[model samples]
Target: MTSHTVQIKLNGSPLSLETSKVAKQADGAVVVRFGGTMVLSTVVAARGPMEGRDFLPLTVEYREKAYAGGKIPGGFFKREGRPDEKETLTCRLIDRPIRPLFPKGFRNEIQVINLVISADNENDPDVLAMVGTSAALSLSGIPFEGPLGAVRVCMVDGKLVVNPTYAQQSTATLEIVMAATEDAVLMVEAGGKEIGEEQMLEALAFGHEQCKQLVRIQKELMTQAAKPRWAFDAKEGLDSGLLEKVRQIATPRVVEALAIHQKQARAEAIAAAFEATWAHLVTVDHVADDAATRVKTQEYFEKVEKTEVRRLIVDKGIRVDGRSVKEVRPIWSEIGYLPRAHGSALFTRGETQALVATTLGTKNDEQKIESFEGDIYRTFMLHYNFPPFSTGEVKRFGTAGRREIGHGALAHRAISAVLPSKEAFPYTIRVVSEILESNGSSSMATVCGASMSLMDAGVPLAAPVAGIAMGLVKEGDKVGILTDIMGTEDHYGDMDFKVAGTEKGITALQMDIKIGGVSVDIMRQALAQAREARIHVLGKMAEAIKAPKATLSEFAPRFVTIKIRPEKIREIIGPGGKVIRGIQEKTGAKIDVEDDGKVTVFSSSAEKAQQTIDIIQDICREAELDRIYLGKVKSIKEFGAFVEIMQGTEGLLHISQIAETRIRAVSDVLTEGDEVLVKVIEIDGNGKIRLSRKQALRDQPALSDKEKLKIVPASAAGA
Candidate 1:
């Protein structure tokens, strides 16, 4: 057997990608083992691009079969078909970091696959897959500027740990998985127990420091097995000569043109300048101008719009909205914007607007998440919808595309930071954000609108969170950072780093660079600037509506829960849900029970919830007894007789303890319902009360002990 290995220090430990018997058919295959877990990754690129492709046709698939841990499929007719939630999330992790690393305009039909071969119970498959993909891509002759590496960092006891185990992640206050090149951060996804901003930044830095080593391993593998990368027919860049003309003509006038600030006024002035400047070239005398001149004239006009606008921002240091670099556009928000929605909010930031609606439901509404771990439940989910009309374009709205899923997921992560814990709000929450208008950062607008809609539904958020999109245009340290960037700035700028966060720290960040990679110093500066703008956005949100209030809508359910002993839980919820269903049917309420023996009752009305609570308590309540009762014999024995004392309770009356009248055969002494005043003597472990007809007479002191003893002895002798 031929064996090959590529080793590098990762997270301060020796890491290796060993190939011997894994994925033998692939163009380039390697088994990446991290800690105790392992993933087999293969990279294969087709001879050419899939015909009629626009963007780089890259496909990343991560699979976790049940047999990875030697387990079988659980349900009937077992087979794995759909990717689970973990698989979906892991696929995103791989796609995000590597998508940017591919050389721009390299539209090749490239596929990178990571299949979990084995999963040691303590290790994470996601982290290992990330490492394996980078290694495979590096060795596959793909024009990847990668060797990008990822690490999962979490805070355990306030100390950040590198590449934490699955167990450590559950209890950690922070869960951060970030990828980085040696020079700059490529991607980051973090959510947790409200980690501090400084700590999150520190975690990112630590993760990057650890990931550098894995990236080194990729470089070595590339040197060993890589083929010459494919070439792309590069297209000409923007015309500098024509752009210079427009910049010269429009740079000065932009200040006065944009001072009007309204979109209509500025667009008119820019349009008039374009028409008047090139009137003669397409005049009646030369209506059929040559193709080159016509094309050049059109290109000149396009440059005026793209460049002069940027030049206005760069040289004058002024924004098209007439604000300074650090300034944010105005914000306006309102809830109950739509009458039919269960809950709705209209969030407008500058020109971007989102009408968000929230709907809550019973367990039936829960989303079923299947992962490598198997089936799970997602009680809270957020979906975002963007119609072409949002951008004033006419198009069909139907199924969700990758862009929609990606955008929605970004917003989902941002507000997930402050969503009420399941313990506090048990309903399955679904939020849908409709992009009513778009100028820039529609996804960020979704984040703001979703928060407001949740509050409108009376969901108690940890705090109100807000998102702001920050852009940067840099050429050799002559950098301009635009806060709350608009559509035009985002198009012309080199970087669009969207940061969505709360006052505490960042919740979600997504950055796409038009230029290669931004410096770490710029990222830090962007982070700081994003933080300030986010705070202001949050403040404005609070102004419209503060944190979620205590009262839910009248149409919403009222929740009340009671904690009881775990053992008594079954009795409270009687046979086949007879007890619980009875309570709900009787009071028109809903109930959810937890394994910890907590019963939560929800109802449309408070009265209905209280009524259900009363019934549940009665079913589970213990009875108290003090007085004696007349009992009848249910069965006979040599020494005693079983008697019926209460509706559901039984008592025993011994033969010797019967009345002074001597009698033989217990049936002759007492029949069912013979009504004898019986005194309670003792209750046994099984809750059976012992009763004696003669004991009732002993309470009278006038009857001496000798008389009582004589009476009992006679009865015993007869028995």
Candidate 2:
């Protein structure tokens, strides 16, 4: 194979795809470069399908090397470990769009690997990797019904920007990643700041046009270096008569099982129907009862079930749970369910329920992430956990998997839009959602529970947020969009569209189509319907908690922020951190000082917090002219005496200013370790302080008893 390259100008940058230069042995390989960032994508398929496989065995891996960003790994091994959260998310971003493009019944094991070879730290490589995956699959001739294109669109200053750089995305109010073919959109994942549905539609349309341009470029590359088509024939392994018999035996019973509203009951009924169907075939028809025959029978039974479920929705307008197409399920919620937690909520919609808790910490609790671009610290975090018992299953517990990460990321994005700024809140927040029961849309449940929990914890959110999952059943021209879809609807439906936001507009959205694609009009309708459902959910949530609590929980820590001169930071920290440590130890408080002299103290008791604040203020206090202080004489000299005024501050008492009359020596009026009242008579430009005892004696008679009592001795001031 010889090297072939194609280039185009996109969004004011040179975008290029080159092939046959690296990994030639793989079925297909492409290196995609945009600006200074580059991603190498390769696809390889097994020669034969895995035995007994019933689904597509596809795996997508994305890795970022430290050298790509001109840095080395941080750990002791000095090498990359497992994929971090960002890499795992990017892998899911690349896999979701292309996975549906493969033909049905094609069970070949395919692996797609994307490596970030160069990172300029401006343009993100995830979108580029998505495009490269589609191009590589198209060029591989792996029966992929594609040549799709992907683009990132961001709305900045009321205008949409295509393929915006990382800096542009950071400031944009709305950011959307869309993938599409020439005619229709295939996938969409987006997060916004309460953007309206119409605005989102316009952005999606704008991004699709850019996708078409990339599709053309991929087609040109295929013309130059595409491989010959691989020979794969999908066979119906079951005998025609046996399949017909199984369908007849299972269709009625499956429909009866689907009528059951409860998830557990429906599952048991379905299982019984499957067993009865297989048993009847073996006894009444004298059919063979081998393992292979049982597998075929089960496959046929599932097909019948899927067909009947879709028929009930599309033809009869009757869902499995007997709800209208646009009706949302029942909702109930409670706040402050846990007395000890900072905030807690139990949100249940239909059969799905989530128990969410919110915890608040100081700046030290923020999560630090190392990425190709740079290190990032996040003050707000949301974690979603799905236990096996939630769905009535028994399984081993391990670390979070890809599904949990993806779901948590979606919910995190949804609730992030309404959170208060770090400066306003001054506390690190973590929200954890535990799924107690699951029938459908547990991720959306997490979103609702988190929002309520935050409000119950007294975290002032801009607005309440809620999420709903919408499903679609399309049979040719007949289309049914179901609101608040359950697990059964999601499994057999053609689309799973999750929308989350406040009453104003949408904050996060994710859509995946199982079929080839859907038109823009269908998407517009879905969004409109989702908005209606989202508003209804929000109304129910408001009934539980109208607004954030007036006061934080007693168990939560109290925070106080104060600003001081930048130079005074060293004074607060002291040499070897002894000063700050002393303050914390004395008052049972935690203090964090920023470089710009912003000090935040956290404590459980208000009196202790105030004590800590008073200590910091005294250490950072400056001498003021015309103000009098009680001073301690530290030393004596022939020319002048240095008197200690504020903590860590001293002033020079000139021999002449020491008394009303001229003194022969400084020790005549003041001795070492003597406490005397002095007034700040002058402050020089170089910060030299001059104190006079004669002026203090004249002002002492005019001072009120309350003002005199407010003054403390210099030694006691530091204490």
Candidate 3:
């Protein structure tokens, strides 16, 4: 049996990592404890690399097992299966900080398994998991660049706090997870209410200070109980000798073709050049042997090349796309391009086209999200769907790949900068971007098309934001930044730095460098260039549709709101919410109320909303009235009846009023159901009823058929 103990101080709590006391037989195991949460991390290396694995094949999975905190599975699958979005996103977080820490040419089939055995819900287990991974790799003889540490810093009550509890994390205005080398900031992901750039920088500094102790522990683990790291020869990047030879041969002609910058023209020219040399010592002729051929085949093409490609273009005023460096691709677009959709746009830039559609929904249609802080409602969602036909191919149908999610998430962040606040539109919106064509920068095309659809649907966005993917080719000390990278460049270039923003400033940025990180000077240059391209994209977008339309379509629901005292909420809802049910039935509306006295009433028509509002008002109203009684006919011995009058209320009248003229049989003059106006004569002290028709009639005039004698008799009987 082997024993290991690693200790550190985390956010003022004494934390420790111990193995053997827990899961003893794992290939490499470490128990991570921060606050009261415990995450057991284990690293298991496969006997050999999976042969056909296209990628590094390192899997980092963090599971939130139900029994971690004594809860049973709640869904139909019974137990957790595939990773949820949260789990996937967390794995990315862990992988990013550790992936770069590995040494060059060091590839071992590795899988990191993280299990949460206890959750105190105080210190987040995610960051602790990252630290444990570093320790596990440090002691397991895995060639990892890690021994890196991470921390989550939040702004609470105007003060920066380290790794706050779940309760405190919500109230926090800012949440930033910072991972770093001992020297510089390596990775950062954050969500905040428009925090300033400078403040975010400061938060990173605060996090780094907190992460120092964990780094120290990683060094200790590496020094005390570490396996010998594996060794492999580091290939000195792309074949430099072959690259130089090809540069000399192809540089001037390639530069000339690229300077023209027509999508098809540049592509044809490059193909023509490569075709002429197809039979030389180029890629066509290769040696045998499965292993060596794969390596030599890629290497052979470089040696046949000659002259400088980028140097001739950048320095000698030539270009690969046959155009000036600052120029954009030819662009065209249209909206309402599809009539069946609520809102739609077909955007084209060069050969790329994205047919984007937008669907606006009500609050109830919002996406439900479950996170460590429990569940939440998301009012805005953007999804990117790519089918085989988009690229003219066929593949297996499955869930969205990492590329789809990453692109969709990028677009979502870009458009989110301009979306109306929840207090404004109050309707949930979901936008789907379909890539119908491909040339380059499809994600940026989605951004442009999504903006048009949003405007068409009458959403009052702050502005129409756009995105552009910029590429870079770095040779020696020189780097050439290309605007609106094409499909080929994105696959072969050294950098892909996508930027999204309004005309004034940046909204979101995602940069991945192929040859380590970029210098600040290059980043500034790239940012400036991306901004210019974005302005062009935005201008083109405006040609389709401008600002958000003033009103939603007729098919959209009408919103009615009512604010009442918070204490009276229960009164309106009633026991088991019986009153609410009655309101819903009477007016045909869907009503949802928050605890803070805010009520939302949704209906298909304005009339229904008005009717519901009226009924609800009546139920919540108080009123008072005066007097009560009933009156009878004066000579009703043989006559019918009459009644009294009150505000909007009525009673009957009797036929006894003709009494004074004659007295016997009483049937001579009056009948029942006749109208004789009456009033409340008096109120009994005990609140009993009282009535009098004769007194009321005496105060008014009494007209009879014979006394007035307005009719002249014709033949006596017929008349």
In candidate 3 the C-alpha lDDT for residue 130 amounts to 77
- RMSD values, in order shown: 8.0, 3.7, 9.0
Model 1, 1-719: lDDT tens digits are 67678876544555678764567667667797766567898888877655445467888888887777777866886866666556767888888778878765566688888888787665677877888888777766667787878788888888888777767876877777877777777777776555555666777788878888777777877776666775654443334655565456554555456556766566677666666545544553344456655455555565556665677677889878888999998899988787656678899988789999988776656898644444568888888788998877789889766567778888888888788778878888999988988888899999999988988888888877788899987756578998999887887787878888888877777776655567667878888899999999988888778867566666777778898777767866678878677777889988877789888887888988898887777556443344556454566777777765543345778888776667676666655545455677887777667777776656644643554332322234335
Clashing pairs in 2: none
TM-score between model 3 and native = 0.74
Which number leads on lDDT? 2
lDDT of 2 at 285: 91
Error (Å) of candidate 1 at residue 406 is 3.2
Task: Quantify all predictions' global Cα lDDT against the true fold.
Answer: 0.74, 0.90, 0.67
> How do all the candidates rank in terms of TM-score, highest first?
2, 1, 3
Model 2 residue 204 CA deviation (Å) reads 0.8
Model 2: per-residue Cα lDDT over 1-719, one tens digit each: 56988888878999999999998888889999999999999999998877777789999999998888999998899999999999999999899889888876787899999999999998989999999999999899798988899999999888899888888988999999889999888899999999899999999999999999999999999999999988766564547798899888899899899999889999999999999999999999989989878887887788899999999999988888889899998999999899899999999999999999999998889999997668899999998899999999998677888888999999999999999988889999999999999999999999999999999999999999999999999999999999999999999999999999999989999999889888888989999999999999999999999889989999898999999999999878878999888888999999989998889999988888998999888878999899988888888889888988876678999998876777788866666777778899888998889998778877876653444342344455456
Residue 328 Cα positional deviation in candidate 1, in Å, after optimal superposition: 1.8
Give all TM-scores, in the order shown: 0.78, 0.91, 0.74
Weakest lDDT window of 10 consecutive positions for candidate 2:
704-713
TM-score of 1: 0.78
